[model samples]
Target: MKKVRIFLVLAITSLIAFTSCNQSKPVKTIENLKAGIIGETTASKKYEAFAQKAKEEGHDAIAMLFSAASNAEAVHAANHTKVLESLGEKMDDFTPEFEVKTTAENLQAAIEGESYEVATMYPQFLADAKAEKVQKAEQSFTWALDTEKKHNDFYSNALSALNAESESGLPTGYAVCPVCGNTYDMANVDDKCAFCMTDKSKFINFD
Candidate 1:
């Protein structure tokens, strides 16, 4: 009877952590979600400022891209906020910090930020959620991760064309996915967002 009781106790403890004995499990689901919110909020604000600077420099296409990316970052923040609330978690107060520079400098900063999120931050958050079996957190991170890749690419291309001052290959308008924060070319988007499958009709467009 003593041995059987000990085994039952072990089984109960197992339910609280890792499924396997040797593999370590993460336990920071809420922390990761909050970090995502803070990061996205800052990105949104920075992009908004960058958009204004681009417009001042007469780069309409770059300005439009920044505006779309700003909207997308807000969507990602909202998604993370929604998931956090559903889990009965409250975010701490946060203020966005950014510096606006010349269009070329601003584009470089945007590219670097997006690359970090796409390559490091979101991937770590998603891994944490997966290890902890947090489905909502996982979904939020996945959406942000996919969208950040697009933002990184867009910023890179914009920086490359900054020197050429060519709008020929640039998008005329920009659209953002409401659910996943994916940005798309307004002239060539499908009926639905490729990331979240949200209807394109629901997308917010900026020309």
Candidate 2:
């Protein structure tokens, strides 16, 4: 009878352990969501500053691009904030740190920042969100991650064109998806945002 009781106790303990391991949702935390929100807020403001500088420098096309990108970042920031709020996470007011440089230098900085998001930051955040089983956060992070990759390519190409001293004509139109903040040159437009399927007609046009 003693041995049987001991065996039953072990079985119950194992069952409890297994059940705990199979939790439907990840452990609740909003650190990553907060960080993402802060990052997006900073990027939005910095890109707007960069847009103004680009316009002052007579890079109208680049200025428009930056402006559109800034709007997109704002959208991402808003999304992150909503998610954080939904999770009952309150973000304290904080100022973001960034430097505004000449258009060329700013482009380089943008490239580096976007590259970091694509290569390091977003990937880790996405993994964490996944591990935590926060599907909304995961989706948001994925959108930002994919969007950052596009921004990196855009900045890199623009920098190369600037360095080449070639006449890189400005696009006829620039559009940003209101839903996802995806920017498009619109020189040769896509029917819709590849990431979010937002209709092209619904995009915010930047002059």
Candidate 3:
């Protein structure tokens, strides 16, 4: 009987230890979530400043798109903050980057930087959120992806317009399908380039 008691006690103790060890630390509090949202908000603001600079530098369309994207980011940030608040957390104030020079070089750099974040970092973030099963995060990520895709299209179109307006007038005569790389003058342009037909908006003014 004594041996049985000792064995049962040992088993209980082991179970307690195992349970304690396996218990997850509380999920990060919502305050931490707010901080993350603030960070993204800051980034979006930076993009907005970049866009403003681009506009000043004659990239009007790009600037407009960037501004729209910035607003989108702000919406996302607000949503995150709201979620955190719902969880009873206070958010910290965020100050975004503001240094911007209205020069072609600066504009190009800003566009490229934003592109990298959207194309690379954002996608990875989405994947991570999916792995973690954060439904809200996934939704936010999808919104961001869609916005970035639009931004990409805007930038491409703006660049094309800029090039066309440059000293060398739109390359004369040779017809180039904006939808597809397929080059054929007015005579061609059947239905639409297979790739471009998928989404006509993605087509830049190639000719």
lDDT scores of the candidates, listed in order: 0.88, 0.82, 0.54
List candidate 1 stretches off by more than 4 Å.
Answer: 1-27
Number of backbone-clashing residue pairs for each candidate, in the order shown: 0, 1, 0
Q: Which pairs of residues clash in candidate 1, taking residues 3 or more apart in a chain or in different chains? A: none
Residue by residue across 1-207, what tens digits does model 3's lDDT show? 999999999999999999998864214434335544765587578767877676567655555545555555665576666656655556766566556664445446556755875678667766766665666655555555555554455455556666566623222222222322322222333455433342433333322
- Over 79-146, each residue of candidate 2 has an lDDT whose tens digit, in order, gives 88887887766788999889998999999999988988899988988888887878888878888887
Q: What tens-digit string does per-residue lDDT give for candidate 1 at 1-207?
A: 999999999988987555555453244888888888999999999999999999999999999999999999999999999988887778999799889999999999999998899889988898888888889889889989998898888888888888787767888898988888888888889898887788988989999
The positional error of residue 117 in candidate 3, measured at the CA in angstroms, is 2.8
State TM-scores per candidate: 0.86, 0.83, 0.54
> What lDDT is obtained when candidate 2 is compared to the true structure?
0.82
Backbone clash tally (model 1): 0
What shift in Å separates residue 116 of candidate 1 from its native position after superposition?
0.5
Instruction: Order the candidates by TM-score, highest first.
Output: 1, 2, 3
Query: 1 or 2: which has the higher lDDT?
Result: 1
